[model samples]
Target: MNAQIALMLGQDGVTSGAIYALLAISIILVFSVTRILLVPQGEFVTFSALTMAAMQGGRPVRLGVLVLGLALAALVMDVVADRQRYRAWIWPKTSLALVAVGLVVVGLGLSVPFDRLGMLAQIAFTLATVVPLGPLIYRVFFQPIAAAPSLVLLMVAIAVHVALIGGGLLIFGPEGARTEPFSDAVIELGPAMIASQTLWVIGVSALLTIALGLFFEVSLWGKALRAAAFNRLGAELVGISPEFAGRTSMTLAALIGAVSGIVVAPITTIYYDSGFLISLKGFVGAIIGAMSSFSVAALGALLVGQTESFSTFWASTYKEIIVFTLLLPVLLWRSLRQGSVEDDE
Candidate 1:
């Protein structure tokens, strides 16, 4: 290929890689803290994208109900847990607050109208509709079995994935949508022009990654998460709550997934099932990193992105096969190098 063609391809690859890197990090975060593979991570992406698209089109985004409903369920669970601790009134108070939030969201959705809102407000609404589901899902599905073995957690994650797929189908229907671009501006490179959204993808991904690093290195909550990830039992012994780690990790994962969705949606059509494939690509990168090393996983995801882009240019029909093929050697090499280890008694 000529130099200009190569530059274009590189740009596309880096843009796509930014999203994959975010997904890889989100997957790694959830897996590291909770030991669950978090296969349904993609659904969050799809849901968030569709939610934004719906809002942009002036449809009453019903996602507010989703967020509130899940919150209510978690509140109920909390109330159940707290009653035995002599805080029986916690349930009623939290339930009232949840009900108020749900009603406000519903009312605002009906009265304000999405098209009338500014872009910033629309983005805020989208975030409000997607981010809380993370902690709610964690509370409902995973918290009770927080101490379960990795195998059990993986099984449960698979179940959650299937459930979320169906939930996505119901929520979004079978149609696909591409939202309006965050910015239609273009930037001139040496030989090729790049969309501003590409910069958005790369810039936001880099910032979030750096922020996450700083969080772990500098913040109290980050230290708690790092401690839990390194040794759960030890973290617990030192008063780091496992539930807190699980909830926080899931929240961060959802945030990453939502942002990835919103950022990429304008570039391509997104449907209910789109998330699975996106998450799978990220998982391939995760596997390449042995699913634990953050830097390696990010690099692997960038490699996957570049491989997919170049492969598409060479043979569009075989692009996916070519991209997926890259995972085999990495898996084999890791398998051979590590062999197998027996669990300690």
Candidate 2:
């Protein structure tokens, strides 16, 4: 590829990777805290994209308005679902949580047939159905096995994936829907051209990341959640409930998904199964971070994005191969180092 073309491609890859990194951090956060892989995390991205597309009607809405609506809808759904499925359960809290989760999956499954609704309405319904469903899953599957092997919780997440995929197929059919980005214009740089939409994606993602980081670092509730994640028993000893932490984390995850979807939706078509693709990519990014630090995950995303962009320009077919090749070496080095440290200890 020409130098100019290579530069442009690299920039594009970096942007894409950054978004994936955000997703990775969100997923890693939940996993590290609860030891439960959150399968529904990608759904949040899909839900946000669909909602933004639905609300804007193929046109770009103001970013502020778009963010506000998506955030509000996601937050509301999360809070309501928590109360209904988890709080209302009478049996062992874990069983109740699972039952609540089942209700959500069933609910989303049913809503797929209502394709006639405008984008806004569909977005609302989807968010409303899924946000609260997390706690229910906790109550049902995780609760019963709370004391069991962490692998069991991981298995529950896999089950969630299976159910969500099946439901998407049943409800939305196999087709995908595309939404136009807010802007179609591109700006020329010295050696690369930047799409306005791409800039928006990068900017919005950065802003949200910064905002969330600040919140977690500075806010009382944020600290509580962190404490809960780090040590549930310790947090509870200080009166911070693990349930509260879990709920908060889920809510944050939902909002992150919404923002990611909004930024990514315009560039690609969204379908019921879009979550699977996103989940895979996000998982890769999260793993690159060793599934711990959010900042590291974000940086990993940037690297991945840059690699993809550059690879697409020079070797489109081998873009993924190239990126993973780089990732493999780094991962191997880290693994060996960790092993050495363990041996020394």
| Candidate 1 lDDT by residue in tens digits, 95-150 | 45555666677677666788877778887877777777787788888988887888
Q: Candidate 2: global Cα-lDDT?
A: 0.67
- Top TM-score: which candidate number? 1
Roughly what TM-score does model 1 have, to 2 decimal places?
A: 0.93
As a whole number from 0 to 100, the lDDT of residue 27 in candidate 2 is: 90
Candidate 2 per-residue lDDT, tens place, 1-345, comes to 678877777777767776787788889878866777887778667655654554445322222232233334444445566678788523344434534444454544444443455545555554554455445445444544554566777787788677756754554456665566667898998867888888888888888888888988999998987888787789889998766676667667776776677678878789867886676667777877888878877887777777767667678888767866766876897888788544311
lDDT over C-alpha atoms for residue 158 of model 2: 83
Clash counts for the predictions, in order? 0, 16
Query: Which residue segments of model 2 deviate by more than 4 Å?
Result: 51-130, 133-143, 340-345
- Could you tell me the lDDT of residue 219 within candidate 1? 98
- Per-candidate local distance difference test: 0.85, 0.67
TM per candidate comes to 0.93, 0.75
